[model samples]
Target: MGLEASNQGFIWVVRRNNNVNGGEEEKNEWLPHEFGKRMEGKGLIIRGWAPQVLILDHEAIGAFVIHCGWNSTLEGVSCGVPMVTWPVFAEQFFNEKLVIEILKIGVSVGAKECNRVVERIVKREDIKEAIRKVMVGEGALEIRNRAKKIKELATMAFEVDGSSYCNMQSLIHELISYNA
Candidate 1:
């Protein structure tokens, strides 16, 4: 799909495994080699792991294929990039709900169980459909607009008068009082 002409403008980035969490180290090393055989000349950029913040920061990033972790969810939301949600774990399902159902800023890739162990596989058609909806399909404009609005709110949370900022100050004052 990535090598297709229509997807030329998009960059597909993937994280193969978690070496830190005891993912198969040998296979993890070899997986990239195998991956490079197909994706080296193509537009895909595969890595073991890197700071998602850096990738999401790019303006060209339209949608994120995320496992729906809270941090990844926040990064995608705060950056105003709509998501292709594939949540696999406990809180991640809730995060997917928050994005797709509550926040209305993303589309689901329909990953029910955890893919870490391959209980369920999100197929190519599912991926293509989600990507199309996010990048160029019917809901693209609505998704993008909602994401921009969310980005604004996420930004305001960090300002001096924002909820997050005030909450931080309150926590600090409480800690000081306790020490005193």
Candidate 2:
């Protein structure tokens, strides 16, 4: 509902949980009624696992809505895409802080509590607002610039003389010497 209300083109990836399904009849009961029909052209819902990296790297992908997991956060950063953070558990809230506060590359959906999947803690308005902020709000350009700069830095870390490269080399040398 939020994505639709945002009036932005989006691709949503939905995971299939074996435990949640009680045969084909209740397969899509979790979604808003006639969601697919309403979002036909504006939104694409990919079931199961889609190519996340490929989607993020696409030029049309303006912002990422994520759970703020470490890998997803890093992926969003590495891809130079700003995000709408909706953290649920574990280290996710910390990661959201990194993205929203430290990095200034994301907007939070005001998800404070970490609960089970059955609870819908974040409201549609919150999601819409966060997505709007990341996509076209006042700070959107600055956030995007920061995201791109971080991506460049992340990419540079792998260059021959870059910090990460140098560190890797040092580690390899130390290990070789110890083994010798």
Question: What TM-score do all the candidates reach, one by one?
Answer: 0.81, 0.91
Residue 82, candidate 2: C-alpha displacement in angstroms: 0.1
Q: lDDT (CA) for every model shown? A: 0.78, 0.90
- For 1-180, candidate 1 gives per-residue lDDT tens digits of 422423534555555655687764535453334555565565555455666788788887888878899988999998999988989878898999999999998888888876666678666677777878888988899999999999999899999989999999999999999989
The digit string of per-residue lDDT tens for model 2 on 1-180 reads 888888888999988766535543327678999999999988899888899989998989999999998998888988999999999988998999999999999999998877665575678898899999989999999999999999999999989999989999999999999988
The candidate that wins on TM-score is 2
The residue pairs found clashing in candidate 1 are none
